[model samples]
Target: MNNASSSTPLGAARGIDPDLIAGIIIVLGAGALLTRTSDMPGMTALLPVTMLSALIVLGLLMIGRCLLRRRRRGDPEATAPAPLKVFDNARRFFGIVVAIAAYVAGVALLGFYTTTAVMIPVVAWCFGYRSLKGVLLADLIFTGGIAIIFVVLMGQELPTEFFLR
Candidate 1:
């Protein structure tokens, strides 16, 4: 076996684009959400359906971009496969997914604001952030934005914090 052939990235050799996979996954997720929201009352369903539709559109755009790039490069037919880096660390990827699941569960138990405030800093730290000030600032800004969007702008009631009750 040639050394160069052995060194080829798995995705490149397989003619698989990670972005294309991601786009298809996103579209499928959005489609699932759309189906789940279909039976909701008209006013309640409007926002979710609209957002899901937008998600689908964005996913389609990603897929289109990938296809265009492949066409331009004459992928599969081309002599050289473009090296692509997928997940650098599978552990970190799975860790983030677990963190997100925890975050979702925390939202129900601790309330949205409280859970989010804690999650932001913790996630930031896990991602190798060392600046305490930066993490705190990010936490504040994100929570504030959520508050402004859901409470002030949309006049939507968020999950009540236990202490605030």
Candidate 2:
């Protein structure tokens, strides 16, 4: 196969844009998040609900951008796909999904801060991050952000481990 064909990412060969597919998936997940949180009191769920709402908006924007790009198909740059680094991006995507499932389930047992702090680095690795510093930085930034938002701002207590309690 020529370089062009080899460079094409997954789903493009069948006329599907992987980005568009991801956007649809993200939107659906966001909708599920909203549905799950709907019954919670607004005061208790304010931050999570707000974050999910933003995710939905971003997902819609992604979908719209993909549609617009497809409509304006004349540009060569737009037509070309990114280089195929992975044999199938699906494996990486699946890994992320599994990791997320575990993280969510872990939160109840491990508590929010600890689960989040640990999961951030694991999820970053699932996304192909290799640098130690990069992963550590991501963990720090995200953990700090969550602490500030949920702990300091919202004044919500994260569940503590049995020993820590």
Candidate 3:
């Protein structure tokens, strides 16, 4: 009898590989720590401090779970299958590039709020968010929050074009 259920599935479909996730988390944590430790001007220190602390804590927790699993199972051979190469990952990166390009191109013409507001939904849709309601919700949340932060709190001048004005 083929023990399909008993056999652990390989690859991305098998869900997140604990070891790989832990390794990534550890690397990210270390990088964040290094960045935080480095001398930077003004508020940059806050960015790294918050990011690094969160990353280190999360990484340690993940690593701890993996170690516990290893000890309990006692199966040194328990290995996750290799991940699949997906265009989605590449597409997401490309989407970010597209957003940046669009932002730069549209800054003077479309203005910050308009360009960013449009980009968020468009990018969300490109990244597999199908529902219009969900896209709108995300776009509103992101754009509104950014607007409040930069324009309201920080008092930064956003490009308010003819359309927005």
Query: Positional deviation of 164 in candidate 1, in angstroms?
Result: 5.4
Task: State, as a TM-score between 0 and 1, how close model 2 is to the true structure.
Answer: 0.68
1-165, model 1: which lDDT tens digit per residue? 686775654335557777888899999999998999978777667778999999999999999988876675555555545655667688998998999999888888889999999999999899899999999999999999989987887777778886877
Error of 3 at 74 (Å): 0.8
Off by over 4 Å in 3: 1-18, 29-37, 42-44, 75-119, 154-165
TM-score of each: 0.78, 0.68, 0.50
Best by TM-score: 1
Residue-level lDDT of model 2, residues 1-165, one tens digit each, is 585664553334346665688799889999998888878777778877988999989999988988776664534555645432333777776877788799878887877778888887777676678898988987888888978877788887777754575
**Per-model root-mean-square deviation over C-alphas:** 3.3, 5.1, 6.9
Q: What is the lDDT of residue 115 in candidate 3?
A: 82
Q: Give residue 81's lDDT in candidate 2 (0 to 100).
A: 51
Pick the winner on lDDT between candidates 2 and 3. 2
Stretches off by above 4 angstroms in model 2 are 1-14, 74-88, 124-141
Q: Which runs in model 1 stand beyond 4 Å of their true positions?
A: 1-13, 39-47, 75-81
In terms of lDDT, which candidate is strongest? 1
lDDT tens readout by residue for model 3, 1-165: 355544543323344444646567686857756665667655545545666777777777776766565454444466544443434377666868777888788877888888888877777777678999988888899889978976677666668865657
C-alpha lDDT of residue 110 in model 3: 80
- Weakest ten-residue segment in model 2 by summed lDDT: 78-87
lDDT of each candidate versus the true structure:
0.84, 0.75, 0.67
